[model samples]
Target: MPRSPYMHLPPAARSRTVTAVLGPTNTGKTHLAIERMLAHKSGLIGLPLRLLAREVYGRIEERAGTDAVALITGEEKIIPKAPRYWVSTVEAMPLDLETDFVAIDEVQLAGDLDRGHVFTDRLLNLRGQSETLLLGAATVRPLLEKLLPGLNVVTRPRMSVLTYAGSKKVSRLPPRSAIVAFSADEVYGIAELIRRQRGGAAVVLGSLSPRTRNAQVELFQNGDVEHLVATDAIGMGLNLDVDHVAFAGNRKYDGYQYRQLTAAEMGQIAGRAGRHTRDGTFGVTGRVDPLDDELVEQIENHHFNSLKVLQWRNSRLDFASSASLRASLDVVPREDGLARAPIGDDINALEHLLRDSGISTMAKGPKAVELLWDVCQVPDYRKIAPANHAELLSTIYTHLMQDGAIADDWFTRQLAFADRADGDIDTLANRIAHIRTWTYVANRPDWLADPAHWQGVTRGIEDKLSDALHDRLTKRFVDRRTSVLMRRLRENAMLEAEITSSGDVLVEGQHIGNLLGFRFAPDAAAEGPDGKTVRAAAQKALATEIE
Candidate 1:
């Protein structure tokens, strides 16, 4: 029978319930998914990253109307009640809800080490027989097809290789080009160079918060800044239209440690060029360096390792009782050089850390015990949770006090370490002082009588729980081992410097994508003791570039 015009399904999806759309960067995979979604009456769009999820939510709301869209992520939720259109991180999606259509963004990440399993399970486990659209990079298509043979597959590559009108051997970038570096320190250095080389154009880096990053993106979007110095964080969301992207650093640190980029990573950065049709000229420029050569080789060779499994468990909210996992944690292994020391064979104090920290909310009973044994024996174990803030701090303090790992006298010598370690009198102190104000208000019976105070108390507990989470997840609550591991992962990649069509030089590297957008203003000059402007001319010279 001929389908009725009132039918809500896309013509392609009408026959089959599942559809997979795959492509590399710049192939408009996401745009296609959005179009398909528009054809349906209602749908759910799931993104991997919080930033991308938020960006998609904003874009969807702008097009579909505010009442139609809502956003949810691990840290934030904008949806007060159920809305027809939902945008959320895949992990944050409610398991109970039923929707007509589901769009899974970045479906390629299903092969990722940390959260690929989430995608796999979610795709495999979706209960509702709704039409599904899977969007991801080209490399991910085969994997998805293999996993779900019932789905239809569509593949697209980059329309054309980018080219530029400028000379090939150009030493410097042009006025309106951007140089992308991988690290915060290098980004700042490159910004300084832009000031020195390009008549002091203000450069924007990627380390700034989302609000600040958006502001920086506007400067580039509005043509307020001619050149931007930034990191990979700028690559995905802002969509700054630019003529060229130059690699500042050639390498980047992966989550666990520094590593060279594979073909997929390099393509992502290079693909950022010429996103807008108006900027027809597009190019990727990189300097020759050991790191750069390695990245090139990886891309050319298409060398990449199979995805590794990353096991992460929530110690706070997942399990009902913390006391259950305590006994098992008591017999785990300690120290780095130890071999497969089984809990049944060798007993160590380190194994007891989870128990001592009051975080027994792990895998239930026997499985929890089994996992603990594996964690102790396995060399790659990275612990994620341990309990409440007080338990965590108290455990660390107790251990440190007994072992004297951190010198006690250092706390007394405040002036010596004040520069290295932020002092009580610094910005954190001001924040802490506000607690006293709240305490005084709480002491008043009249203030306590108000319902607002009760809510405030609830908020305080949530804040404490959040802080506990931050400390544990960030390795702040744990010892130096976890912190060192995190640092190693962060420093894996390096940056390579290159020149763009605009006669501007930039640093670039693997994993560091194009500057989607940027915004920054030149610092204004300050007055000197003699009443003469100190660095006033420098500031004015810098601001002039923006104008």
Candidate 2:
């Protein structure tokens, strides 16, 4: 059998020291990292997206065997007793591990203003003897090499082009084939088009949950999906095989208006094609805008291939204070400020005024609002905030009540109400009615007390449910023959039938179901148009076997 592509890597690349796998897209860097883990016996893989992490876990299991792999993303954890291969999001990864290797799949995230520091710190200082591999798009490849001088650099120039359909004047796609757009509206628009024109490809947004994103990938891979309408969330380690990648939109959210894609971004996404063996058709397609021919030319020329150093700085609202827009500005020079009066009300406002006074360089316009949400969720946000923090606290509290633990939601709501009489009215007014409705359905005495397994319904509702309902439901379910059979199946309980040496038993096999009188409905699926019923098939199979 042929060796896997991941199996053969140079010793220099797999040493017990930091190693960098910097390159353009589709260079198979992630696979290389996995191979290093396999050879070294243990390692942790960090991916930016949960879907990618989950997929990595599945692949590792397929290669290493069940229970040999573990997944630790935000959504779920399959922690093996002695897991040798762990897959997780960068943030979810344990701060310290005794493993032989740590690989950050999309290391260029070091340029992100929000979570970039985590990856940068990891690249700069990881304590174990284990090796580290930083994989990312080509634009930031030089930055990693500069930061880590001992790092090994590998560059795989993209071999594919992005192609698309539309008139030249339509510069940005309405959302067709992986179009790059800045706003949520553009993504939705593109998604709608794919749904109508190309048989409905999955819409990929940065904020979508891991489970939902994986479902989309599955649909695409299984041929049920046509296009993948996505944001930059798919730019990194996602493995979506496509014959043609079209930039449906040009404007990327750079803090203000949706602007055109930088050469680096165009190159980053184009690299996704011709991945593994590289014998496929991959190209870039986009609408041409006469106003921005220079950008188009740069994209076509691949001038963005040269490594450019970028700092992680972006504008953001100062949720710390009462004033919103003034949060992320700069201060004016002493000489200029001395001649003028105090600029703005708060620090944020002053900072913005300083920008007007030519005090600071204009950074990327805080392109990602999702980053703020994640940061706010951090337990330390309170420690970072200034006074008058109620409104910010309220916003964070609302989000938690919706997405966090149910108990936490109830506790926070109660705490909010206790804090102030107005707090209760404000909190209740802003809250979605569905959350309360769901709470009611989830917590009703009859529902809770019912004998349903309940685990699938919600994990934390068990204690809150009425004991009486639980007992009643349990008894009813346990008494059912079907439920009993399912339990037996789950337990892998074997059925032992006794027989005489002459083949005449205490009871003949021919009348087995008659004794039990239970139908083994093998075809207990939906009714089909062929006129054959699943229950009938099950009955026939049971009858044939027994007779």
Q: Compared to the true structure, candidate 1 yields what TM-score?
A: 0.56
Against the hidden reference, what TM-scores do the models get?
Answer: 0.56, 0.54
lDDT of 1 by residue, 454-534 (tens): 335533533443333222222311122211222233344232333234423222211111222233211122112111111
Residue-wise C-alpha lDDT for candidate 2, range 213-237, written one tens digit per residue: 5655655565444456667777776
lDDT values for all models: 0.46, 0.47
Global lDDT of model 1: 0.46
